[model samples]
Target: MNERLNRLANLPLRENLQGLAPYGAPQIDVPIQLNVNENTHPLPAEVHRAIVEEVSAAAVGLNRYPDREFTELRERLAAYLGHGLAAENVWAANGSNEVLQQILQAFGGPGRSVMGFPPTYSMYPLLASGTDTTYIPGVRSADYGLSAHDAAEQVKAAAPNIVLLCSPNNPTGTALGLDVVEAVYEAGRASNTVVIVDEAYAEFAHTGTPSALSLLPGRERLIVSRTMSKAFALAGARIGYLAAAPEISDAIRLVRLPYHLSAVTQATGNAALKHIDTLLANVEAIKVQRDRIVSELTRLGFTPASSDSNFVFFGGVKNTKAIWEGLLEAGVIIRDVGIPGHLRVTAGTEAETTAFLVRLEELLTQGVNNSPS
Candidate 1:
């Protein structure tokens, strides 16, 4: 056997994969896919035209490798982020996932610890482990809000090298208020630790929820990552970006792969950026849909989180799995969060939301009838 293979062959694979599951969204071919929080709108014609034109123009460059720096996209992203810095403060990757991985590589590793609050995005712990960093959790308060005092205590006690936070956090649609984020940043800065805010759903946040980017001017240790996936309707284009101080961005750039983003992806992302107005309009519509779903779910007797993201999370229903299964059987699919009796449903188009509610009503009625009197 090869020496490296022989050295690894004796090790248990499960040990490396502890506390992680295979990562993927569901693949059901349901007509109404409310499972993943993808933007339900298709790309508008103008955006589509621009993407096609840009990609076609770049097609001749297939003979050469893409620009390793992705300079133009960086400039465009910097402008989009609206901080005073230029491309020096921006880094692009295959997706926000890669952006996150680079952040972890730059700041987290063996013997160092990374911290996060749970019932947030599921990826933080996995990313920490992939970078060989110790993963620590500071579970949120029972109300799904971050306890800044507890977080500060944890940071002081653990002294982790990196702290990951998600605003308008995933799976729950709850946001870390700016005050809490600033408190976390201060704690991390005092420890010489890096703080990363994952703002994948920032566009959908309720008005006045300050973006961590708004707080980045004087902070050297803070990084805020954003994606064109959710609100931009470009999940398939795979463009994720980071906004940070120049030094940190440079460190992230060093660890990322050369040509980390393809020429086509850069072209597509730029085109999408040009249509930000239209995209935000779609986000507005989705917000309306989200509110309707929340109110309807409440009236249906399920308790939902006061979500500020593009989805709603509700619980307190009996037979959660049965309701989920029933929805699937009815050709509507929503996410089954592992939290007992809780499930998440993404805001879809008006038609899709109507279908989901209709199916949910059926499930509720059936559940009541099947219950033991």
Candidate 2:
């Protein structure tokens, strides 16, 4: 390990990336794995067949470069979103991470900056650094909530070139009200800030929760990003996209690689969009399990947050590390997101959720120890 570190240090790495660790969650091979916020439900047979058929057709054209514009995929995505968006208003990349990275490359760099509220998605700062943009860390409330007034105040004060808002925020599972998005956008108008709302977990959000996509009508600077990885059960397919003004997609074109999205990826995303209703049925099931996790966690004496996503973020653990390890020992793994008394767990299928809850309850009852053995 020391030799590997020394080798890396000797290489001419980018200054910003020198000391950084790659982003990832534990991929432990446990029977009940809920560490990452994945839609643990399997795909429906019809969707599976559609993807297979689409990929098989796309495979025949592997000899040629894919359509640089990916027009059909964009059209399908726009129709899926259904806020009167057109294909020209959409852009996509390998995944949402790449989509964000492309955004940073286009709009952020040295002398520019991006701001994001902390205890939020961990990638915003990394993306900023990778693009040589300064990252401004904004704060959240004591309970990890951000209000419209406070959010607007912070935006007005910072005036960053780019702003990232994660709705149904990661590691917290709470959605931001559109009021906050509107306020932040209004506040950033003075700075001409490009605001991005990442709705990776939007499909799992509670009923009546409005998406930031609803705010896109008159706001050319606002971008609403979504991912098929979570709701469409397509994590391995790596399709993430955004809806914004046509000019935004045009701007991203300047920074995006030629034919960045492959033929197979376009085919897969198009096929999945065809079966949107079927895939979303699974989202409803996940929501049921999510609510169950929140209810059961509260009853178990843990302070679970009001989750709008498919995961539950809870505190009130006596020994977080101990409980995490205890569950691992019991063949059920969840996320210990480095918060002192807090952890996040993905709401998986019914059996998977039950396995996690049962193991967690047993560990709490045992008063599991965190100290080194």
Candidate 3:
């Protein structure tokens, strides 16, 4: 083993954390990076200016702690959601991962368990483990689809205290229907399970697809988590939030640290919200590229899942590792999501997408295909 690992192994780390790898995607510098599902587009110049101006204003007040409640930020977010939701129904944190962690903190722990459908966000189980909660993973269909019957039946059987459903699931790019959401909720009613719908990729979902936020009227146990990372082109901002019952927000308050969100974060996020339209201007363009990647991959005889999100998950590789190395050699870096014979790639700029496609085609033509023995 390497010296770094050897040194770490000698430390007095907790047994549960011992030998557990940190959650991370490779961050190699490449000409075209489609590994992480980050927005390829940068913020519009106008939004950049607004953020700069707001943060500059906030800088003067750095001597004092920000409003612990983040009142104005929540108000703006509630208005943006527009489901008649007030600030009381919203909660913000470092990211949706933290938001989910706080959820597990408040509602999950020892003796209580949280569950999720697999090949979804890889973070769900990690978040549960971090909160000292037991994690139970449910199975999805061969095609990575989870129907209402499948969800309800599994939820009823497991009876976990918390259930996480990732819409437009990561590494699969398939969306969960509202029918599935309703079924899981109904099944958990007797047990009072908290159902969380992670919608980090919500904004990139295809038109006419409804958000889980629309289903939050009387479902007190339901929480819809969202992020500005994907569609708003603000991954660097590290702001994510959730909309649920006011009581749910109140519960999270018990776990969140005081002044967790800084004045600069509140100001920058508010500024971004004010220029939402401008920030979202590139979403359609990104969608067009995403669709192009899917169609082109299909035409190349690869089976790419129908993608509503800003990325594509394609399969049918006989040797994913070989293709990964080949792509890297060609300066195109994508993700190997630990799924056998499958990989995912975020939709990059038009030129970057073309580069990826061309490089992939060249590799295929050069006999990079390695069938499983």
lDDT against the true structure, per candidate, is: 0.84, 0.92, 0.91
Clashing pairs in 3: none
Look at candidate 1 and give me any clashing residue pairs.
Answer: 168-175
What's the lDDT for residue 262 in model 3? 90
Worst 10-residue lDDT window, candidate 3: 364-373
lDDT (10s digit) by residue, model 2, range 63-90: 9999999999999999989989999999
lDDT of 3 by residue, 1-373 (tens): 5899989999998665678777999999988889999998878999999999999999999999999999999999999889899999999999888999999999998889999989889888788778878899999888889999999999999999999999989978888899999999999998899999999998888999988998999999999999988998889999999999999998998999989999999998999999988988889998999999999998887889999899999987777888899999989999999988888999989998998999888877877765651
Q: Give each model's clash number.
A: 1, 0, 0
> In lDDT terms, how accurate is model 3?
0.91
Per-residue lDDT for 111-159 in model 1, tens only?
7888988887888778877888889988788877787787777887878
Work out how many backbone clashes candidate 1 has: 1
TM-score of 1: 0.94
